[model samples]
Target: MAQFDVSLVLPDTLYHGSTMGAIQGLRIKPINKEFWKDAKDFGAGFYTTIDLFQATTWARKPVVAMERLNKGTDPSAMVRSLPKDQIPVVAVYDCNSNLYTDNIILHDYRGESRAWAQFILSHRHSSTVDNCLCLNEFGWIHPHIACGLMADNDTGQIIEDFRSQGRDIHNRDDLEWFWTQIIRTREGRRLNGLELGDQIAFSAKL
Candidate 1:
């Protein structure tokens, strides 16, 4: 089993006390699949980033903006209105990759191969393509993992544009080209694997 020792950082500035409480209490749960389905890029699962800066941005997202974004409404203003704080704490975990054997799907977009790009587009645009089915066909749903093309305003807009246009409206070459550029600097990673404990170590506020 590939073992990973990683840290999940939650910014107190972005989340309410109760939300932080939940994380501290180990009560945080993955977003439900139904709601996650419409979520940009990969459907719902616990999301994390190896980059602390990226994670800090996620943790600092305002609740109202998050709600609006999830509802497909533009929340650019709301996002800008949110205050940035430095009170971020990290939750560390030791993960057993073996536990992900039948449960995890990796999108290794960092490579030159176009496979990850194709899979992302197909998963996003194909009405008949069920991510659950994709997971099951490969194995079982231990969890969800998206390696490349980190979700952000630019990438999110790309996804929205393609989704609004419908898969057939755009040429595959253009889509493939766009994705190739997006994943160029992305890293190979996974999320929601089997965590060994409820509480590992929490980093002091950064």
Candidate 2:
């Protein structure tokens, strides 16, 4: 069936797709903010997944992003000590189930919805301080553990396409203008089920 981190200390199994080769040490350190300048689906964190296929898809990202002008590494990845030319790899972290739960806030977005779409936009296009729960003492969204759909890496053109039609994604009118258009693509797959891939972003925080 399905497995949840019973102890809440960690998950029974979380897969990480990367090109960093063999991960050193037993610890999982999320990439630094400087590594990625773009807005992420769940802010910036160590993104993983319970779905094997999804993780496999992630394995392809590092490679594809490297060749493409858009990402392919984002150029500034050097600050994070990430390699530029390497094969994407999916590192399966088979976490052990234990018994411990406290001071952990996890927001799981089961399937796509208006709230989910809006949440992504808040992290990408703008900031929603009130809705953001991962804020720091300074009221900045440091982000928390968020489990949701993988952000569509190819959203730029989609945004531009809508813009050509004079549709502003940031517009709240016309029933959350942004969501109406996005749901028409991969993110909209929620209507049936996960068609692209899934992910769970683990924050750098302990």
Task: Name the top TM-score candidate.
Answer: 2
lDDT of 1 by residue, 1-206 (tens): 67755542332221212134335343344222322333334443444444445444555555644665578655655555445432334433334444433523343344334554554454455423133334433343412445544432245556667666554414767667556444433342322222100111111110
Which digits, one per residue and each the tens of the lDDT, describe model 2 over residues 70-102? 544554453244454355566777665344344
Count clashes in each candidate, considering only residues at least 3 apart in sequence or on different chains. 1, 2
Scored against the true structure, residue 27 in model 1 reaches a CA lDDT of 36
C-alpha local distance difference test of each model = 0.40, 0.57
What is the TM-score of each predicted model, taking all chains together?
A: 0.46, 0.63
Candidate 2 scores a C-alpha RMSD against the true structure in Å of 7.8
- Which segments of candidate 1 are over 4 A away from where they belong? 1-37, 63-91, 98-107, 126-146, 149-153, 163-171, 180-206
